[model samples]
Target chain A: MKAVTYQGKKKVEVKEVGDAKLIKRDDMLVRVTSTAICGSDLHIYHGLIPGMYDDYVIGHEPMGIVEETGPDVTRVKKGDRVIIPFNVACGECFFCTNQMESQCDNANDAKDTGGYFGYSETYGGYMGGQAELLRVPFGNFVPFKVPEDAEVEDEKILFLSDILPTAYWGVDNAGVKPGDTVIILGCGPVGLLTQ
Target chain B: MDYRLEHAKRTNHVETYNFEKTHDIDQTLLEATKGGADVVIDCVGLDAKRTAMEKVETALMLQGGSLGAFNTAANVVRKFGTIQVIGVYGLKYNMFPFGHLFERNVQVKMGQAPVIHYMPELFRQIQTGKIDPTDIITHRLHISDAPRAYEIFDNKDESCIKVVLKP
Candidate 1:
């Protein structure tokens, strides 16, 4: 299978990589139909974010058809179209139950942060979604089922993997109220989305 | 340039600023908002305001870049106003405006945005016409052009606000 891999700082290339398959009982294999380059990925690209290893596949946003699912994965089936969240969260964890999947204790035990695919060793080193296929851990908890009848474009919904929700989280975190003036400094995707 | 400053003006009624043009952002915003802005959010982080040499030093890992935007926020936030820092900052800073922020009784909230937590509501909003996240995508390239795409976005080239790579 073909996937994008990190060559070095300021370098990324399309390369042949092994195919993805179900690794854990809660895992699901996704045939990626759509993916986006996230701002967080750029951080990894620049080598600014630590713990990144060479040849690590890099991406976070992905939505596609579920090719296979582990027996423990109850929320999504093999043929279902789903959007995979960047964080690989076990629904049973303390943080996951508390609506904090990004900080789920079960995914990345080395740090307080949860498992984010393709970030590096610090982020649990899961292979990313910018590939022919992806291995999604704890699939039942993270894969959001897209409606069969809905007709939204992949470009429109691909952001659900990270940025859109992140922007919404920013506004929500700031406790933005009606008639309140909120100032955003950076005009990057996340900042623009927040605006 | 797929700029959306007009949207801010129309919906949020926000006024834009070019910090380079205005020598004193705090003074300008202070006067414009009548004393100060009620809420000041710092999305610009470590590299917010740095001299050319200062940037070089930070790049060489000499001095830590921190609180450039926070200082501006501390100055422009009204008495008892709130300042939300969305920008990532350093663990240590040579100088911090603790006195000003403390005296103003300003409320501050800062942290990583819990992306998954907000996904459901935002997804619903996008399903409706309430929000459009795709509008920010200024460039789209093939997966083979991923390297160039990363360069353009990192450099902010050609007014590139965002890039969505088609893989």
Candidate 2:
């Protein structure tokens, strides 16, 4: 399958790579229908992120059909339309249970930080979804089920994987209320979404 | 081009300006907001514009990426105001403004977004048409164009705000 791999500073390439395969019992393989280049991805593209070597797959925002699921997957199954959140979280962990899945204790073995897809090894060495297919873990939690209705387009919901939620979280984090004067520093994707 | 600032105004109906264009963003924001804004959100993170010294420090590994936005946040936020950071920052900084933030009793919150937690509500908002994330997408290219896509996005060429890649 062809996936976008990091070449070096300000460089990326579409290269044929190994097909994604389900390895863990709760893993799911998604045939990516749509994926996006995030502002954070540019950090890696600029060679700022450590642990990213040449050919490291690099993307996070993705949504598509669940082509296959591992034996133990239950929350979603084959053929389910889902948006994979960047965070690789186990739902039962303390942080996950407390609504802080981004800091899930079990996702990343390399560092204390939670696991994220396609990021450098600091987050997790998981391959990103900027390809034909992606291997998603913690199937019971990570794959967010999109509405089964056919009306929703992939474009409408893909940002839910990151920017939309990140924007909302930013507003909520600052306790901004209606009529309050809030100054947003960056007019990038996440910043614009926050507005 | 000021495409990004214009897009924010036209699409989101927010008053926006380019900080780089202003002589002093701190003074401009302070005067405009009557001393300071109630809240300041630093979404630019480590990728913000760098001064010459910052470039040297960052290149030497003595500091993380530019703290320009964060420092601006510290200066332009009202006393006891809140500063929320949504942008990604790495490692440590040479001169983090802990003393100023502490003196002002400012509150700060930052981290990875914990995206899964807000999925349900945001999805509902999309379903109901209260928000449209797709509005930001200015380019749609095939996966094979990954190199050009990254270049355009990083350079903000072609007024590119966002790019979606299909395989």
Model 2 TM-score? 0.98
Candidate 2 on A120-188: residue-level lDDT in tens? 888889999899999999999998998787488989999999999999999998999887789999999
The RMSD of every model to the true structure, in order and in angstroms, is: 2.5, 0.9
Give residue A12's lDDT in candidate 2 (0 to 100). Answer: 88
Highest TM-score, which number? 2
- Candidate 1's docking class is medium
Summed backbone clashes in each candidate are 0, 0
- The alpha-carbon RMSD over the true interface for every model, in angstroms, is 2.3, 0.9
What digit string (tens of lDDT, one per residue) describes model 1 on residues A1-195? 778888888899888888988888989999888888876676677676667877788888888899999998888898888888787788787888888777788888668778888778887878888887899988778888888887888788888888777767767766778987566766666666777
Candidate number achieving the greatest DockQ relative to the actual structure: 2
Q: In angstroms, how far off is A102's CA in candidate 1?
A: 1.9
